[model samples]
Target: MQHHRGRTRIVGALSVVVATLAATLVPTVAANAITGADFDPGHIISDLQFYDNAAMSEAEIQSFLEARVAPTGCVTSNCLAAFKMDTFTRAADRNICTEYTGGSQESAARIIYKVQRACGISARVLLVTLQKEQSLLTATAPTSWQMTASMGYGCPDTAPCDAQFYGFYNQVYKAAWQFKRYSTPDPWGTYQPGNRYIQYNPNPDCGGSWVNIRNNATAALYNYTPYQPNAASLANLYGSGGSCGAHGNRNFWTYYHGWFGDPEYGGLPGVTVTRFDVANRYESSTRISQEAFPSAPVPVVYLATGHNYPDALTAGAAAARQGGPLLLIDGASIRPVVDAELKRLRPQRIVVVGGPESVPESVVQALSAYSPSVTRVGGADRYEVSRSLALTMNPQGPVNEVFVATGSNYPDALGAGMAAGYRKVPIVLVPGTDTALDAATADFIRRLAPQKITIVGGPVSVSPGVEAQLKTFAATTRVNGANRYEVSTNLARNLYATQRPTTVYLATGLTYPDALAGSVLAARKSAALLVSHPYCIHPSTLSAITDFKVNSVTLLGGPVSLAANVKYMVRCW
Candidate 1:
């Protein structure tokens, strides 16, 4: 039941004293691009948006409330930030929410967590609803009535507040239950995820418009509110609206966008993809490394800074040649998680790539505890580092094969890293923008005197002059395509020319960290490392999947880096 304007609508839709407080909820840097005009009445949010209970922990929820309701300005101890209540247990309901195991003297955050976990609704949604429905989020001195109708669960425009759902805990629980109920089988019969004519207001004359609801969660939102905002409401979302306007649904969109991110899942559902991820890039590297080398003590481990990308791929290549894992770090100190991984790997020797600036002496000294022999291989910059690393990889002359790629960017060079490792050769780096090969790389190429030279990437990545310079030294050729994804497929296609590879590593082309580290794992497994769009695998990558007869694909990063949607469509192509 919504209280619009003078009716029991979304009261805060009109500007009040809490405007300053409302602004703080939307972070400036995280400012959502969606505007009021972009509001979709049918698809209010996604199933993932509504059901991701892990979106916020109890501590995070408490912090959010504390940030919203500043204690010094608060006149009432009854604010959500300071409020606490004894909570009870709830039984599991498949159609609605799971059983909530409540406890005595529960804080607002705790109660919210229980309800969120049990009902499988995001606590973020619960927080936004509190702010939208009653401004309870920033309420300095709310009346007993405000908390009573906290979520406006049983408060309809035509009737007074229901006494049974009076308290904050009760309101939160019942509201979560009701929303979950709407998502169940045979949901509110009138509203499913399709076209539906929802009214603008309680007034019969207000009429309705057709909205194609996206999912069950969206359907649940419509069934709960039962009214759509008129054009006037969308025109001025932050404030009040026209005569026939309803702000319940409008405020829902604005609050959600401002507080959380865009709740819309414009993409498809998640495909079953094995995401080798933890908290961040460093952990993701370790997770991927662990997957490649389940147990350790076999040989050596390559250490590189997760912050610096230039040396990571070469390090991965070198590590693969030695049959080891490439681990990423902060360069300054060893993370407890990294330390744990090192202790598990129990490498005979740890090789630190890059100069002191990249992996300083302190980190090297600290790393000595994990391995008996620790060595450092680096030079002035990434180009020198790559040269020195390549030389270190093969100290002897007559280096059988050589691969060259741009140091300026990562994607084109990503597939080359695995190819170099597969042949146990060095992958050298040169500045891509340069017209010709630099003296150091030329001298290194002369020293190696390779039988075959394969320049990975298009002319943009490796210049024609550089290719010509390489041809002077040996039989130089190129494996390239229009884009990073195509280049990746071309390199993989060249590697497994005679046989189909069994494994493939899929990493996001939008970023380089995961691909940089995953390259080694792919090489170790004799698999292809394909660059992909965050949301979907490229056409070339899909074709490569089929051509190579890849039975497994390990997605390198988390959902944000490479969306699960891409994983679902991998089999399609």
Candidate 2:
């Protein structure tokens, strides 16, 4: 349990180990003398885009940590033990909940997952630090000293080690929270993209160098350690005494490389389309989707008429799951963007959603020029069209879940559809009236026999009668708010109740074109779409921003659809 010359140790036996560390360990300050040329700004420690652009779910983080084999020193030969230690639960307001999974909550993996999500920090980086600072991760039986100062966060070389920060949860939570604070823009914040003066040792004699931090994550690491490794120090991985060089940052880089390849991973391919001044909303929506998912020779593509919302409401999930984009068309002639996108995609099959009235036969025939395998899934009406699309996408088997939205309105269904898309579930269109479900919808519900039904919108959009009818088919839960803005917020909250969304998409509630196309992209990005007014953001949407602390916001459409001032407000929020 002794805190050696440059390493922090966590012992199981608290009192005995603390005395041992205090008596045996002499405070050793490592020098950080290095040249500015030694630094590579492009070679970041971690890429924020990896979290923002990629679909990093809680399950993914847990699985990654659990997959690692047990290190050399664990007494039980358990890798998860490395992440677990006794902690004062309520100390310093660090109340980590025990309940992560259902029934009986347990496991160190759960604790790491919760803290990582809560602080918006990567779990990969946390584990690397635990290993780098203490070797507690691989120790035969970690001492209380190592567990207490698990992250070596508060135990700086220049000052006395803080006693109040003792305990596993406190160390990890505070350390992760500090990393987040570093990324933030403040006068004291050091982890911004710029050249930072890092010292090798606390002593002025041990000169340091200026290193250019490429990204926030790399800058965050520098802010934590305030040092850069010299060539001599990095030459030997385990050796300590070498020309007054820091080992913390060096070990972190090496450990991360050995375990997870490159820490700065790639992001999803991004594309942007120009908003034409004369082009209608339908054309704009199609163009946006086409640019977003520019996969050539796609297997399938979803086509929905842009005049109404019902048919397109449920198409997002299916399109996202299939790695396809959602395209909007007029009732008769195909929009220029639609026609151009169809040519670019060259999909094997085009699935036209909606009735003949919504998307006419002429449009279906016009699609023959692009692909020979064009298939129309039109129904008797909008409700029937939704049913047909659902049946086609999910098939006639037991579905995981289904979303029921008011067929009459667009706002409730817009956000609901995006959520369903992200969840990869089917959404059914129900009558907006305060009455029984439509025959087509009811018949489809009975046929598919879903496990859960999420009804979107208030009583006016989807009445109690529909809820009762849905309950007979599956476990029903209604998500409603005072208005469409509130309803969108509620939908986002329900979908990502436990974790924050990777990014948020803000589109105008007055129009459907921007969000309709953005929904498919949002699902692919694993993001939440929140609809607001053209001029200002709703209070409910603002509440969501505060709750989740969402920093990334992508404004759908141009200033006309969502005002520039509104976009600014949303982003600043």
Candidate 3:
């Protein structure tokens, strides 16, 4: 995020000559400074093109000029003549016009007139420094005429052609905001940091050369107001003082004299100074939050699976044994399965990991066979399963933590889950990809040490090496096949339900039908089910659940379906 600028002896020699000439020949125009009335839109455009050929295409420049002349009610001739003469000094000393190089300044003021009009701060303020220090108009000078390069004329060998002007502009903008917070007066218009400006100089105590320039400039511009030094203010605004070094230094008045020589030069009309404040604001805020992470609370996670499939059953059981909630979903049979699990595992929450296609027929028949559980069913719909689960886990309250082990393609859902998990721990991804997990994911998992890891796809999708590594961490991991109902049910029971529930159902066959049969039986028992076959319900079956008042649903791998018995329960009597 930090940019470096180079300074060499050659820039120093140029600085002396430019500064001497600027001091002698640049006659002080009227002290009142040219206002908007004096500028012409046409003139601004012509002059901008005249000084910098690339300026016309810059949107910021166009916008700025258009706004200024729109109100003046003047055409190209009058507007162009007035703006050129007043701002550029009739093109005789075109060097006074400088191009903004910093991404921010360049973005804000593509053209000098645009910058002036938008900021209500003068381009002259920036131009004066460019004229005295870098001779911006001269092609002979290096392209690093930008204020972002470095302090002084000498470009450093490291960043020989970088500009540092935008960096300074960024500092001032931040200072303006901070000042706005504490005081009503617009600091951007008057308050200047002169003391800290001197301190930032590499040789502040050597000869007071920078100080003299600052003082003289302030005197000539704002008549030298009684300004005190505030190092903390500068640091807070510009991020200087400690390890950040000169780039972080906001002690403007002390660091550079080019800013305050003429009030007319300092204030441009079109530029919105606030744009530069974004970088500092974002950095400072993120940094402070990162520092407070260690003291946060911990969160509990629940893993769920489809009914009776040995693999999923094994994974869920392992998770439950590790003190994490493991639930099984089998269509309308989920309640009894949940009840049974509640008695055995006694988890605090429940979560369903598979999709609607996994809903079991026996479970649906069992629901149809019973009246009380049927009444609570509220008609099975894919959305209902997800909604019901959401209500059960959250229960009109905010969830502090959530961990999703779904596929990588579900970025939106993954992001939401990660945000929830962020309250207590960082979001980490276990090795689910065929290739090794990237550094970021590995690092996050290492940091979190989550008690339970959910595998969205079957074990086949997860690298064996990753699974082995996860087992070594002493964390319980649950692997679920691709079933939306199972996924949603498991998540809900673990996160929102009044109490965690678990029930085990044995699948007789390893094929898809057996998995469905087990899921039905588990559902009949009111327990969350975990299955490991592709025979889960179809997407239509899953979508039908949206009509019901069910909870959340998670669809694992693929190939889904709903049997006739399960359809009866999902559709209701």
Q: What's each prediction's TM-score?
A: 0.62, 0.51, 0.20
> Candidate 3, 184: how far from true, in Å?
10
Model 1, 392-494: lDDT tens digits are: 6888877888999999987877778878887789999999778898898889889998999999998888889889888999998999898888888888899
User: Over the stretch 162-280, how does candidate 2's per-residue lDDT look in tens digits?
Assistant: 87777667677777767766655452354467776776654456677777766777776766766665555545443442546566666666555455444444322231212222135
Total clashing residue pairs per candidate?
5, 17, 138
Off by over 4 Å in 2: 1-279, 570-573
Q: How accurate is candidate 1 locally (lDDT)?
A: 0.76
lDDT digits (tens) for residues 452-565 of candidate 3: 544443455456665665555435445342443344334334432453323222121123322222232233234333332122233333333332223422222111122111
- Between 1 and 2, whose TM-score is larger? 1
Question: Which one wins by lDDT: 1 or 3?
Answer: 1
Give the C-alpha lDDT of model 3: 0.30
Between which residue pairs do clashes occur in model 1? 3-8, 3-9, 3-10, 4-9, 92-99
Residue 300 of candidate 1: its Cα lDDT? 89
